[model samples]
Target: MAFYLVELTKSVTVHPRYFHAKLGDHVIGRLLALTEGTTSGRYGYLIAVVQVERPLPPGRILPGTGHAVFPLRYKALVYRPFLGEVLDGVIASLTRHGVFVAVGPLSVFVSARNVPSDMEFDETEQCFTSVVQGSEDRLEVGTLVRLRIVGMRRDATEIAAVGTLRADYLGVLG
Candidate 1:
């Protein structure tokens, strides 16, 4: 799910104190500070700011402010999960409706309907349990599980995922 070497353009404001000979370094530092660990609306999570391309001339200083704004072009590493991709994560919580698994920064929900048909919710234990032949399987908080991304929904602030563990090899990982 990690995307490497993606080109991007960003605008950075340089304070007057940083206008000296090390201006390029200052600008690059500012760009990394602003973008590293930030999420892109189009891309998923930005892991790091790898490199800065050719630096364009700084734009005109703002009136009365004396700060220079520069358009910076750069490349970054990002992580974006795609639909139908299978991932392993720890179970964060269990609800009456489903299980919530935390996969890095992403939270995925595997609805009750998406769990294996044999599994049933155990209200007293707050977990899902199933018995196949003579063996017992259980899924609870902190359990490691493998799931397939079935759907995703994103808004301005967050991304949510719908997952399924009903398929073969897609369940509690033991």
Candidate 2:
């Protein structure tokens, strides 16, 4: 996965109730609501609003509705991942079954079936653990890990991926 900064122009619509002194803020807020955290094939997942052009553009009110539409140009940070890509992620959550890793804007699932047999779920400790070379290695919440993208699905506002920690150079990180 990778993040990219790009300039984009999006049309943001604001309700009539928000048409006040700070209409610019309202418009930009609406734009952020629509774009941020949303995923598209073209730009992937729009992470954050980087900048908004100064002196907000004029809005055109619709015919039947009183909503104002503004063509806002702005810069944003986006994340798009590819198959077979190796990426570093933090273990957001873990279970006896598997773990959920957050890689940038994408959440990847590392299934237990794909995990190495050397590790096992420690019910008492509530984590995946292993011992090698007289040292203990644990996979728990907040653990840093590296994985390869095995499969992916892009939805309207989300990018779901299935990752594996069994490959070479993959797995727990110190």
Q: Which regions of candidate 2 fall more than 4 Å away from where they truly are?
A: 17-21, 53-55, 131-133
22: Cα error in model 2, Å? 3.9
The local lDDT score (0 to 100) that residue 118 gets in candidate 2 is 81
Clashing pairs in 1: none
lDDT of 1 by residue, 1-174 (tens): 556668888999998998888998888898989988876557887788887887556566888999999988888987787889999999999987999999887889999999899999989999999957775788899999999999987765567889999999999896
Q: Report lDDT (CA) for all predictions.
A: 0.86, 0.87
Candidate 1 TM-score, true structure as reference: 0.85
Tens-place lDDT per residue, model 2, 12-108, is 8888999889888888888888888788876788889999998888999998999988998899998889999999999999888899999877889
RMSD of 1: 2.2
Using lDDT as the measure, which candidate wins?
2
Worst 10 residues of 1 by lDDT: 51-60
Measured on C-alpha atoms, candidate 2 has an lDDT of 0.87
